[model samples]
Target: MNTRLQTQTAEKGPVSVIAGPWPSYASFRSLPERERWVLYGSAKAYREALEDQGLIMAEGYDDFVRRVTRELEL
Candidate 1:
């Protein structure tokens, strides 16, 4: 268990257990950063819409770049 995971778990409660396959790392990474970010942001919205939300998106440094690209549709 990573320290961040521990902290988030403590703050937000337990992690959700997802049953379906997550998007592939390559599919996610190959996307332009901004494009990816937009997609991810939309995905986050979708995730939150669920009655039993389980998605956790803890983005790193590249996250912003990805988000911008996705948002701009570049």
Candidate 2:
């Protein structure tokens, strides 16, 4: 990974995983504010890079999420 990416990921702190299944949005939202900001910042960085590379076209947060969802089939 890129040094900047690694730093950013680390700054976001650790993501705890529950053993059995993925957590819901509500559960995720319950995380500390700093954690949430780190997650959002990381995602924004990635989305900006994808846009720069022409891999994805997104105008803003909502658009970015929609485009990513469509691409990932989520």
Candidate 3:
């Protein structure tokens, strides 16, 4: 098995750390910087990839897009 997967399996339990591995970037952004790094460090590759793509969509999909649109002047 992959080392990463093995580590994850070994730690299969209540996640004490609250960080960017959050469900969404909005959640990650809501957290303090230290917490964000915690999440980034522990987040699954898929999530990190999405974040890298600059494709964050907060809970309310449409609303999040609208907000980004207005904020970015896009």
Candidate 4:
């Protein structure tokens, strides 16, 4: 099975270390360093990653987007 191991970070801090099946790891790695931070994975994995970093999660969907946007900007 295809798999990828990736790390994503925001301006404020490290975001996550993600591991999962991903067919596009090669393409993803080819991206510029600045763009490599944009990783994709299951929502459950993402939520767990964020929580592992002690980030506060928003219960509402809109609020979650806003929170992520704001955090990434930091």
What does the lDDT come to for candidate 2?
0.45
lDDT of 2 by residue, 1-74 (tens): 21121112354453322122211234345567666656656666875675464332314558556544443334
RMSD of each: 7.5, 13.8, 13.1, 14.2
Query: How does model 3 score by TM-score?
Result: 0.26
lDDT of 3 at 53: 50
lDDT of 3 by residue, 1-74 (tens): 21111112243542222122224444346566676555555544654465455434233435544543333333
TM-score of each: 0.36, 0.41, 0.26, 0.27
TM-score, model 4 to reference: 0.27
Per-residue error for 66 in candidate 4, Å, reads 0.2
- Give the winner by lDDT: 1
lDDT of 4 by residue, 1-74 (tens): 42333344575454333333212334455556455446423433677676667554425546544444443341
Model 4 alpha-carbon drift over 4 Å, by segment = 1-58
Worst 10 residues of 3 by lDDT: 1-10
List the candidate 3 regions with Cα displacement exceeding 4 Å.
1-23, 44-74
Highest TM-score among the candidates is held by which one?
Answer: 2
RMSD over all Cα atoms, model 4: 14.2
- The predicted structure with the larger TM-score, 2 or 4, is 2
